[model samples]
Target: MTAIPSAMRVIDVPKPGGPDALTLAERPVPAFGDDDVLIRVAAAGLNRADVLQRRGAYPSPPGAPPNPGLEAAGTVAAAGRNVREFKVGDRVCALLQGGGYSEYVAVNVGQVLPIPGSLDFIEAASLPETYFTVWSNLYEFGRLQRGETLLVHGGSSGIGISAIQLAKALGSTVFTTVGTDDKASFCEQLGATRAINYKTQDFVAEIAALTANKGVNVVLDMVGGSYVARNLQVLATEGRLVMIATQGGAKGEIDVLRIMQQRLVVTGSTLRTRAVEFKREMKQRLLQHVWPLIADGTLRPVVDKVFDLADAPAAHAHMESSTHKGKIILKVGG
Candidate 1:
């Protein structure tokens, strides 16, 4: 095993602003606990939450590292005394509450999974955040069943593409909304029944027409604001509307009458603050159900671009531009 270092490089936000605010600094390596494993991070996945953190909008939860990465893939440098599922030197990816930006991070064993199949560290690095979000929201909360139709907004995003492929692989018909025709084509090739160009098409009308006026069974949305009413409108009777983010804006107006009249389920959740037991259970379920698909190449992560750890600012800029089709990652180590 490589001897763990006493200190490691980490990205820090000196003050909230644009990508320029991100800078590299040295910090003591995080310590591991009885149930924790210390990862020598190879790469870390970037998410919108990082952008929020950079702008001083989203603060890391108490006890989480102040820096902004949400997921990482790496080899274990050490394991806690109580950790048994993974040992030192195991290749793994983890869902993190925060601190993925550092060269070393300590994660509870339950939040970690063995890297599936032949995926290199870069691709494996992109999995946890998007996959966990998709499974927990789309399957656990939404109860999206086989043959059910799911409409995913932000279809070109990390979360969107992950939800699109997984739902489609599991037998659900998937429709997605994207900003560009290129993104639309990419999403369609990834198994979306159709990718609506939200800029040019009224998603509500398109969904209505596509479903022959019946509406979809679920709408997995990240954009909130006015999309709330529109998403409610796009749901069939007894359908579900799962909200995972408020990228458009936190406040959204929904039609109470429409929800009541259609007997619809409107729900939203944030995973970072959820209890460890919940994440543990989710990891087990993903291992049993989704890991095989990943191992066999039926499902895979889509990495749009990679930047060296020092270029986190450029990576964040790319993400904010909203031009990428999938996950953006930071390569932290060789």
Candidate 2:
């Protein structure tokens, strides 16, 4: 490796609103706690949260670097004193609370997962955030089961694709809603039982018809606006809706009567602000259960596009466009 520097190139929120707000700068390399590892980033995954962070809407967690990135694949360049699970030179990828859009980043050792031999850096970089989020919300929290029906919004998105594959592999009948015909086709290829074009089709009606009007057992919702009401309308008598984002708007008048009548459960979670122990547990569970599928090729990251580190703004622009399918990533090292 080149002589290590105290600082590295990073993209920042020079101000909010559009790709123009993202600017490249040399910033101090973050310090690692005894339990952390310093990774030489090979690829960084772009997420809606990154876009939200860039816009000043999703601020970095307290004390983290202002730089925006949520996940990365890399090699361990330095391991802190207490780190033992990995050593310098091990190939790894990590889920980050912030500061992933840099040449180097410090990550909790527990958050680092060994890159499966079957995956390249770009594919591995696309895994952490989306996979973890989907696993936690759809399976763990939502209690999705085999033989049940699942409805996913934004089906072409990283989370949506992952949920579809995971749910299918777990034996659930999955349905997805996409904005366009192209996205709808992509969702079907990922194993969605039926991919509905929300632009020209009514997802609720389609799902109801598909499921014989019995409704779906679970709904993985990211579009929040009026979707809150619609989600309840399509939910089975005793179903769950796991909301991960509010691309549709945060505040909306929900129908409490519908929720009660259907006995629906609605909940949301963001893993970034959770305690280290909670994240550690999630990492452990993922490695134990999800890693084998990734290694054996049953589950894989859906990477749509990659941009050079300097072109992070372009990557963010692609994510904001909402036209790209799967996770957008940044190639960090030369």
Candidate 3:
């Protein structure tokens, strides 16, 4: 095959606010190193992190790609000599640290996963970042178990949707908090046992009453701030609270006595800055356990909308509106 010229659309620095912050510019495409693969990105998913990165708030990791996207689905255009698991033309999606908002992106082989037969390019693109986050935070860190109750905040957000599906499939009683009635219904259709409208409902009291005051075994929160204190109120003894993002602000005081008395575990992780080895381990675990479920269609990406690559600004706007019920994608190669 002839080597295709590298191409990209750059989002200029210091995006102030709104979708306009994400703009497009032509640039040279990236090259792959040994053990990496050159991918022709078919689509990329819009993530909150991407929005934050565009605003100069979320700094790119050291040695991370200049682009802001965190996940994409594409075909292998060129495989490095050391790559053994994939070859040219294989459809795949990758969990990326950066650079996914492009025509093509080079990714380490370890970060790429075979696209499940059940998913198309756009759907596949939406899976990696959210799925990996949900799996890592809810189960690996939170230790959510079967028969236990789990509460997911932002039930309509990408991570929230993922948590709802995976938790339900794993036999946990799933509860989610959504900002709108439509979002609440969407979460229910996605297998959430209970969907509370956070705008009108008291999530803590709702969960407590719903669970007969036993409280939940796991709390997946991206909303921090005052949520830190309320989260403890809804957590059963030995429960875990996994904080992935602080959308509601970070700094706040929590009752230390509540944590100690409840024996609750509190921890969180950000995937972008993690070591390559850590990501590779997560990739392996997902492939071994979650891939099969995805293949069988029990696990699916709840795609709320798709936008043309050129309309990434609009997609970002939709995300900022907080109305989309699931993953928002940017379709390329149109």
Candidate 4:
């Protein structure tokens, strides 16, 4: 095994502000625990959560690195004493509690997975955060099933794209809302039965018409605020509303009568704060179900753009613009 380095380059958010607040700096290599593996990062995935973290609206969980990053693909550089699933020299991608922007990061073994042979490091880097979030919310909490209809908000974003593909692969019909005509078309090509342009149409009304007023069985909503009430209006009886983000606004008004009348379930989750055991179970499920699709080209991550580690600010700027259609990545190390 190669010797661990004492210091590594990392993107630091020195203050709460815009993309330019992200600065390149050097930090000590993170230490690993008994059940952890130290990864030599090849690439890092950018997420909206990172943007929130940068702006100080969202903070890293306790014990997580102060730097902003949630997922990465890399080669295992070292393994903790109790880590049996991976070893030095193995290529992997990981769901991180934090610190993925660095050259190396120590992650719990349970959060790590082997990179598919068919995917390069950049593509593998995009998988963990979006795939895990979609799987856990759409399949588990949302209770989506074959033949059920689903509505996904922000349809061209990383999480939305994953949800669209996975729902379609599982035989659920999908409708998604995007901001532009081009993005709507992009979502349809990714298997959305219909992509509603939220800028030019009322998603609630469009969904009502498309479903003959019967409504969809599930709604994956990232935009909160007024969307909550509208989502309730568009959900079928016994439907589920899974809230992953409140990009629009955190507060939402809902009609208690509506929820009860439709037997609707409103749920949501954040992947970074989940326990290691829980992530282990999620990783197992992905390996059993989704990885094959990724390997065989039945599913592919949409990488809208990539930046060098030093240019993280530009990457974040692009993401905040809300014009990109898929995941943005940072090429960190070889």
RMSD of each: 0.7, 1.2, 1.3, 0.8
What value does the lDDT take at residue 144 in candidate 4? 89
Q: Give each model's whole-structure lDDT.
A: 0.94, 0.89, 0.86, 0.94
lDDT string, candidate 3, 267-300, tens digits: 8888888777878888888988788988898888
Kindly give the number of clashing pairs for every candidate: 0, 0, 2, 0
Candidate 1 lands at a TM-score of 0.99
lDDT of 3 at 175: 92
Candidate 4 clashes between residue pairs 3 or more apart in a chain or in different chains: none
Off by over 4 Å in 3: 10-16
Model 1 weakest 10-residue run by lDDT: 1-10
Deviation in Å, model 3, residue 209 alpha carbon? 0.7
List TM-scores for all candidates, in order.
0.99, 0.97, 0.97, 0.99
Question: What is the C-alpha RMSD, rounded to one decimal, of candidate 1?
Answer: 0.7
Compose the digit string of candidate 4's lDDT tens values, residues 59-95: 9999999999999999999999998888799989999
Model 3 is weakest, by summed lDDT over 10 consecutive residues, at 7-16
lDDT of 3 at 4: 72
Pairs with backbone N, CA or C atoms under 3 Å apart (clashes), candidate 3: 6-29, 7-29
